[model samples]
Target chain A: MTKRSYMAVPFVLGALLLILTGYWGYTQNESRKNLQTNLGNRYQMAFLDLSTHVEKLQVLLAKGLVSSSPEQDLVIFSDIRNEATSAQGDLGQLPLANPALTRTNQYLSQVGDFAYTLNKQRARGKAPTDEDWDKLAQLQEQAGALNQELKKMEVTVADGAFNWGEFRREANEELAVKGRKRGQINLVKLERNMEQFPVLIYDGPFSDHLERVKPRGIKGKVVSREKARNIALQFVDKGEEKWQAVYRGKVNGKIPAHRIEVKPTGAAGVFADISIQGGKIIWFLNPRTVDKENLTMEQARQKAANFLTSRGYGKMAPTYSVKQQNIAYFSFAYLQDNVLVYPDLIKVRVALDNGQILGIEAMGYLMSHAPRKIPEAKVSREQARTMIHPRLDVQAARMVIIPTETLKEIFCYEFKVMLNGQQFLIYINALTGQQEKILEVIDTPNGTLTM
Target chain B: MKKRIGIIITGLALGLLISFGVWQNQEVTAISQSLYWGSKGPNVVQLQQKLKDWGFYRGKADGVYGADTFAAVKKFQQRKGIKADGVAGPGTLKALGLWTAETRTTARKPGTSRGVSNRGDITLLARVIQGEAGAEPYIGKVAVGAVILNRTESGKFPDSLNGVIFQPLAFESVSNGLVWRHTPSADSLKAAQDAINGYDPTQGALFFWNPAKPVSRWIWSRTISTRIGKHVFGN
Candidate 1:
């Protein structure tokens, strides 16, 4: 070979060696990582499995105790014994270098022996005698106690609560000395601490609190306006000394109305005014209540939700809007979009028992809901009239203007209905040609009907 | 010349063989360590055997590692009334048998009867009924529960009672793990079994909700009947 070629050969050979070594190293490292991860997952899963089994066995034992089902007790005991054996066999494969776990395993074996004997006897048609039950119960209690103790140990290990090496050494020391004498710690407390988190409570829209605080009298026996005002004041102040009442008024006759005023103790000029008519809230007058600049949609939503939930109307969802001045306002419905949250009337027909809320038609919620865009007219009032049963006598038929609850628009529609005999209401989807909703009314008192 | 050629070839072959042997040995070592540390292979195999022994898992222990093993594991979990995930995690292993050596004493703690677990089961069943047959009576709820249980019995759903309960939005409570919160009352269990036996008061209803309130329009397309609670039941 040429001298230069001979020299190049060694360089090429060295490069090849480097590449091969690097590839092998990478493969080995990757393999080790994968193995370690799999092993960790397996161990964790195994531990959890063991925990669940113990939990079930405990539950079964409890059932047996309550029902005094010796058969169930026997089954539980046998199952537990079998589980304990299987777990031990699985754990043998794990390299649980921790001494606490090792000691725990040993105790587990002792418990297993106790359970196995009881189960074996029970399976042989010998029900756990009272004495046997007592022994089993004691074992169960001890097992639960030990589990708590071990779990604490596990947390410490998993959370790196202590140095593993030192903790292991200490555990080993504890095991070697008092070993079985290690008493159970209060695990409930530990778990509680571990699980504790935080929640936020608000103190705004204070006027709405009246809705929650005021007690309702049966249907509409005249409610004292004075009582209602005091309740509203109490709600707005939330019993805060810093708040002072400013103004109150009543506008009434057709739709009864009330106006109320309040002033903050320290603030000047700024005040709150509210109005209610026919026992329904009409308007709220707090400049701060309307968010101008620094408010987010989420904040507005939360405020609305808070207002509704606090008012005992926990289910109502409110919509928010920005007024002309860029101030945000909130409004909700007794009947939400296409859904009758609060029915004006609920009619039920009971067949079985006293009665059930068989048929509930919320005409008020439907009529009072937000208007929807008019659906395409398919069947005119004349066509709808044809579909009605001839046997059903028509009392009233008119083309009156009504708001569309589903479409959120205004429309002219027809109401051709009768309340003469078997109560039924036929609603025509004037926008669409289809029958919107048919409600069969039941003739029964509100109190008499089972809800 | 021929002898020299043979010698060079033999040396090359020996080097190649050594390299291949080392590579194979490394792979074997990796696999063994993985098994030692708690690989699925070992855990799954052990769980399958335990379930078969317990009569919950009937699939052959071929060790191919698939859904059958999961189903068997789940069945064992359901019968034991444990939360079922087919993998033989520590919980499954412990349930199948007991672990005595690590931290807690290896003895199987006799299970406790928490008055709470039973009550919790009632709530879960109530929630399931509400979801399945809110408008229907006890019969409707019972039928829905039975359908869920039937799915468990057949190969279609996760076999464990919990697996069936908690099979991702299959039943709302099951998805939320609220099924675990419930203690299965004898009545509820009976109802579930009854529904599984093809006695559908709902006549194979897969969905139900209050008719007084607005439901998804899709529900209208299905043949709907049988109103209970506040909902309409349908297949």
Candidate 2:
């Protein structure tokens, strides 16, 4: 080839490279603009949603101050709760790590919680007390201030003066605060304004200082980790051949417990939770699946009884059985001195295909299995029988303690009777002779249950 | 001693036949967080519908997992002998026959599910009625079928036909192995179909039983509305 032609080729290649680089830069710039715009839209949407919800929240709290009817109070409280939650959620997505934002989140959370507790009270058909009324008035005042400040900020943002790109994920906390310090987005000052807001504590479940019930069954001396492991292994394996249990240390909860992992030979992992003081197995889960159905439910129940009896769980009566696939779950209530103690319950899941115990949950038994003095029935069976309708035929009766509607435990004479070919249980209060509860005996494919 | 030895050998053989290699792989749907009280999402909607289908929930399935939904879930969990915590985690959802997103696409086809949907329900119902009343006259069998159908319609009982039949301890034959052990007869299938088609042979009987079976004295007080074959029907 000629030297002139070779030189021409090099020049053409340089021009081609320059064109390609220009095209690439143009596309990158285009995409960058689109991406930032998309993010800005989301931030703007959340900001608007947050500001408007806070306004609605203040209005609802004001309405709550005037609402006399329980029905109207429920509606106002529900709106307050919804507004508080959505505002909190939107603020979290704002990508602002300013400690000022943390106060906002906390304020919203307390608002939501306060509304929740009031609504729950309304659900039980109760009216709010004077204290709740005062709290609602204070909340309305605080929310009104916050809503005004947010509305001012919203106006500034709508005027195309606010830079949402500054609060992007890439921006640091310092940069976000720089705007707040300059009185641009004065959320920081607004947050500090509400710092003296009451903590909004209530008798709701999440609040601290609530009466936490201690486990009554945890009455023995603290056992060694090794001993706990061995106890767990015993519940895991019934055969004479000793199995192994791996100690997983202590777990702290309402009831303190030692954890153990018992993966028996030729079996799946079985996680066990044993009480630290009594060394009792609170719960154990054998995460194994069985397919074919080999043993009958009766055989499985017998196996469960044998397992319990061998482990010193005395005279347990099977209360309910639930079957899923090839596994049959039996919940046995511990019988104490001929009385069926429903509180002390243990669940045993047997693999019907192999007659192997797949899982055992003894939380009920562990939490409430304390020896109690068997009180004689104040009302005799003959008297309790009179509480029933004349047409009903009596079948079986027992003395038992059952839970009441308001969380009280009542002792009653539980009469299991036949009502129109179906079975029903009538629990008559032993002391008062009033019918405490009547449960229809529902017969399922697996077992009988009183509902 | 020889007979005892023979019995022991027979038991061992039976045990081996029963237990050898019965493990089947279960499809576990991953759930990062449990769906509990105050938890709201699409997943909660999935949970509500499943529990509703199983005769648990009574309210509208409006997808808001509210307090009524929580109570229904707790009742279902109690029936399943589980924690009864009212949380629809992976295990609870699976127990109620809901498939996760991935399983919905990969494990099943659109047409395949609809094919087996009520076919299984009807077949199981037919088998139950056949086993319970096969020995009685054809009218008695239809009456038995009618009772189950009526239960599905009754607001006091479960809504679905399968729910009413499979409700815990609903039928003695179900617990006693007569239902599962027997294949459905043609007459029983026809009776089931007739019952589903709104045939009220027993004049809206909620229950029926053979008087010779030595039931509770309360059975006699039901004011026996009709008697077909050896069975007495009652509302």
My TM-score estimates for the predictions, one after another, are: 0.25, 0.47
Candidate 2 has a DockQ of 0.01
Worst 10 residues of 2 chain A by lDDT: A204-213
Candidate 2 per-residue lDDT over residues A1-451, each given as its tens digit: 5566556655555565565567557766876888778878788888889998898899888999988998898888888888887786666556453233545666676677788889988887879899988877877898988898899889877775776765443234344444444325766667677776665545553232222456667787888898988888777854454467887655554356677777646654566777778888766655455668989889999999988888788689987775655777787887777777777778887888878886676765666777777777788888888999989888888888765422236778888888778988888888878787778776656455456
Cα lDDT of model 1 by residue, A25-134, tens digit: 78778877776567556655555565555555555455545544557666666667666555444433332222113333433444455566655555556665776566
Measured against the true two-chain complex, the DockQ scores of the candidates, in the order shown, are 0.01, 0.01
Pairs that clash in candidate 2: A443-B168, A443-B169, A443-B170, A444-B167, A444-B168, A444-B169, A444-B170
Model 2 spans with C-alpha error above 4 angstroms: A1-36, A69-71, A85-125, A134-203, A207-217, A238-241, A263-269, A287-353, A362-451, B1-235
CAPRI quality band, candidate 2: incorrect
Q: Which candidate number maximizes TM-score?
A: 2
Worst 10 residues of 1 chain A by lDDT: A348-357
Worst 10 residues of 2 chain B by lDDT: B108-117
Give candidate 2's fnat, 2 decimals.
0.00
